[model samples]
Target: MSLIPSESMRPHQENVIGSTQLQFDQGSQPRLRVVTHTAKSILVRFGIVGLARQWPSSQRQATILRYHSVSSAGDYRSPTISVHPEMFRRQMEFLSRHYDVLTLDELVSGLETGSLPPKAVAITFDDGYKDNATEALPILARYNLPATFFVTSDAVLGKSAFWTGWLHRAVSSASEETLRKASDSLIGGMSSVLSREKIYAALASQVDHAHGSKRQQRFLALSRAFHHMPPLSSPSDFMMDIDDLRALLSAGMTIGAHTATHKVLAGLPEDDAREELSRSKQELEQALVTPIVHFAYPNGHVASNVDDAAIRLTREAGYRSGGTSRRGAALVGTPTHNLPRQGINDALGFSGFVFKLEEARFSLLLRGS
Candidate 1:
């Protein structure tokens, strides 16, 4: 099932690996994406995947997997933020059996000590969904793996849905005509063929930076404008309550702050960004009775979601580490305040998931990490 090349092919193989790494690290143009995926497939076929996984340097690099919701809500859920319970269980089982699963604390400690185990991996969940408690916990417990849960204090405490969750529910339940109208209103026009993604993008663009009461006001206006749709479900249905977080803590998982209302800090004024970072840590510490040492920038995947000011403020607020949505495996000397994590979702099936773990590793290895 793996390619075994002769000695004559070694130089050519190195060339292939180098070129693929260059294309992957560059921008994701559609053509480059196709080429990169094809290159990955070719590498996997050539048994480079096995080499990447078993490479000794992999022991020195740690992969942190980021997740949002582990749920069975199916079509009622947003796939961008969820993995079905069964898929999640399988992924965890694979990690338990094949990977060296570490707690976030342990990963940080390893980075500090410059010694990480081979195949080191850490699991983390963001946005504090109720399913992280009711559904994801038992499976993780079954595998005896510890993960970090970065929670938005306001959503959990107020029992309100995260803005993305609210938008998902609205988009999921909206009729085509309603989507058309909302799209037209929000974006100043619309395509003839509307979609949930199109609508969600429109709404997210409108409110991703709105914070506090202003955020509520915008969402309320959206709801009022689309009043014909059925009322959205209770926030408890989407978000974890205080009890759920306590349950996570009781099960020996770590809690980290993800801002108070999940506002993108890089876009906010200095005072507002400070409040989002500091207040979340303070409130969650008070609520959970544990020092919140880690912070994940909301929408941290986007370059715009993180800035020098955001990183400076996170450190000034006393967070020991800050995780970003950036893709790559973290190695020793990777900055404590800007750890890059790969976002795992349902779209990456088990094979894709396995490949992702090594894809970045292969790139790093080629570049001599």
Candidate 2:
């Protein structure tokens, strides 16, 4: 799914499903939140639920919530990934009140020893967006909860929008007809429908499988093949700048490497993958003035995302743990490198979103947990 909008946005933007409320926090920053919105109401009015309401024991399980952007403007590709600040605050408040909001370091300890606080959960933000530094940080501070930021070194340095961001913008701007034709012409044969979103997804899937110049070459081809065509037009400082990142650490957030560039790892050759992983870890450590010990796979998963080779590289890179987008909580005996996480959409509203989160946590549909 698409996330942040410009090389500037994930690259996920979402529509406000119902009403919108804007409130200023202590810093006088305006945040968009849903206060008893439609999405929340229906989920409650209908009583549509099959999951347990009581908090599940986290004694042997740790939940890692993966978030991309918390902005007023969510990523157009996947709005769910980009949550508005007000909505984000509400969720943070709920988590603080209801669950044991532990830090990434604490979760790591739990993973090693197989013991955690009841209802333990850790929050994480990926891609190092400016909003994460500005908007999300304040709320995190308010709740005094700890989060780990898996930053793409390039984005953190404010170089340009990551390839994922560019891909989303180009595809989203294309006309339906253009999108269809583009999908048909996809370099790697696609097995999904010829929709624009599917086309972007299919191409993104292949990026991890590509190595060296082949990934860049195909990316450029797609950029040209798309409607507007070529070059990452996203403005500089679209992602978090170096100062913003340092400030985040100063405020107590842990930093981890997402990669030098936010590209899939499995597709890259062994040497290239190692460089992306180790280089990023080294760069982050040097820049942030801290030992970077964690790694989150770019497009982390078991499917078209991270693989055993990628995991091996992360281990070689000297990371303490790795996180994946796979649904479920990290339980005892779970591989530390292949830890599972639940991706939440704040647009789902408080009650609705919470139910879905708990459902994913306890349901067998996503995993045996």
lDDT of each: 0.78, 0.70
TM-score of 2: 0.76
* 10 residues in a row with least lDDT, candidate 2: 2-11
Model 1: how far is 173 from its true place, Å?
Answer: 0.9
* Candidate 1 residue-wise lDDT, 1-369, digit = tens: 223323343332333342453332332211112225556566667676657677767877899999998986743346776888899999899889878899888898899898889888999999888889989999999999999999988888874556677777777777777767777776665636656776677777778867668877777778775675444334535688888899999999999999987889986889999998999999889888889999899889998889899999999999999999998888888887899898888777666677677766665455443
lDDT minimum window of 10 residues, candidate 1:
26-35
Clashing pairs in 1: none
Candidate whose TM-score is highest: 1
TM-score per candidate, chains pooled: 0.86, 0.76
How displaced is residue 16 in candidate 2, in Å?
32
Q: What root-mean-square deviation over C-alphas does model 1 reach?
A: 4.5
Model 1: CA > 4 A from native: 1-47, 74-77, 209-217, 228-236, 366-369
Clash totals for all candidate models = 0, 20
